[model samples]
Target: MDETHRDRDAEGRARNARPRDGLGRPLPYGTEGVGRQPEGVVRSPEETLREAQRLLDGGMPFHAHEVFEDAWKSGPEEDRELWRAMAQLAVGLTHAARGNAVGGARLLRRGAAVLEAYRARGPYGIGVGALIGWARELAGRVEPPETGAVARPAGRGRATGGVDAAAEAPRLRP
Candidate 1:
C-alpha cells in the first residue's frame, strides 16, 4: 500500500476524506469541516424540500445539492425534471460561491429553464412560479460581467456567493 492511501466509504466506493468548508470546498487534511450529506438516500418530495431547505438556510448549497441530487436520482420518472432542476439550482449557487461566475450564472439560468417546464403542473405544493422567479432573479444577479469586468474587487479572494444561496434560495412550499 502507498503512503498516500485513498479514502473509501464503508461500501468500498471512493470517497474524499478531506474536510470541506461550509460551501463544500475541500480543505487541507486535519482541518475541521461541516457535516456532509450522505449519498443515495431516497426521500419523498416533501421531505426533500424540508431537508434541502434546512441545508440551504445554513449556507450549505453544496450539501443541499447532494440532497437534491438524491431526489433527482431516486424520484419517480414523472417528476425527475423537477428534482433535477432543483439540484441544478443548488449546484449553480455552489458555483457562485466558488467564484466561478460564468458557471454560476449559466447553471442558474439552466436550472430556471428546466424548472420552468413544471410551472403549469408542478407537483408537491411547490411554488413553481415563485421558484422560477427566484432562479431567474439569482441568475440575473449573478450574470457574468462584461469582458474584463469582475464580480468582486481585487484582493478580496473568493467571495461567498455561497452565502447568497441562503439569501436567494426559493421556498418550495407555498
Candidate 2:
C-alpha cells in the first residue's frame, strides 16, 4: 500500500478511515481538494450581502464585518452607506460576544441610523433591510450591565422581528 493512502485527523491522530459519504467512498477526483470560499460570489449588492451572511452563519462575525467593509468601500456612495451600516451591525454583534453590550448597542444604533436614513430609497437590499430591523430591536433592549457604561438611546421598535442575521450574511467573492 502506498503511504498516500494514510489519513490523519487535525491532531495527526491516525484513526479508522470512515466512508467519505453515505455511499462509503472517497470524494470524486475533481472535488477532493475543493474548499468553500471565505466569501462567496458578488455579482451585485444582493449577492455580496448574501456572502456576508455566510460569514455570520459560520460565527465569524468580525470576519463578516470586514468583508462587508470591503464591499462597502468599493460600492457606490449610495450603496456604500447601507453596506457600512450593516458592517457596523456585524461589528456590534462581535462586541456583544465580548461582553461589551454598551459598545455593541452603540454600533447597532449607528448602523440603524444609517439604514433609516436611506429607508426611503428603493430597496435597501435584503442584508441591510434585515439588519435595520435587528438594530432597531437591539436598540430597545436594556443595555446589559457593563462596568462604567453609560446608557444609550433606545431604539424605536418597528414592526418585523428583525431579519435573521445568519441568513442575511453569506460568504461571497466580488
Provide backbone clash counts, one per model.
1, 16
RMSD of each: 4.5, 12.1
Model 1 stretches with alpha carbons more than 4 Å out: 1-4, 148-163
Residue 115, model 2: Cα distance from true site in angstroms: 0.4
How many clashes (backbone atoms < 3 Å, residues ≥3 apart in a chain or on different chains) does model 1 have?
1
lDDT tens readout by residue for model 1, 1-174: 333778998899988888898788888788889988988999888889999989988888899999989998988898888888888888888887677756777787888899778889878888888887877787677664466555656423333343365676667777
Report the error of model 2 at residue 77, Å: 2.1
What TM-score, computed on C-alpha atoms, does each candidate reach? Answer: 0.85, 0.55
Please write out the lDDT profile of model 2 over residues 1-174, one tens digit for every residue.
Answer: 343666676789885343332111345433443132343334366666666666677655666676777777777776788778778878766655444556666787888888787666535345445557767676555245445455445552212333334443332222
| Distance from true location, Cα of 4 in model 1, Å | 4.1
Clashes of 2: 16
lDDT score, candidate 1:
0.79
The local lDDT score (0 to 100) that residue 157 gets in candidate 2 is 21
Cα error, residue 70 of model 2, in Å, equals 0.8
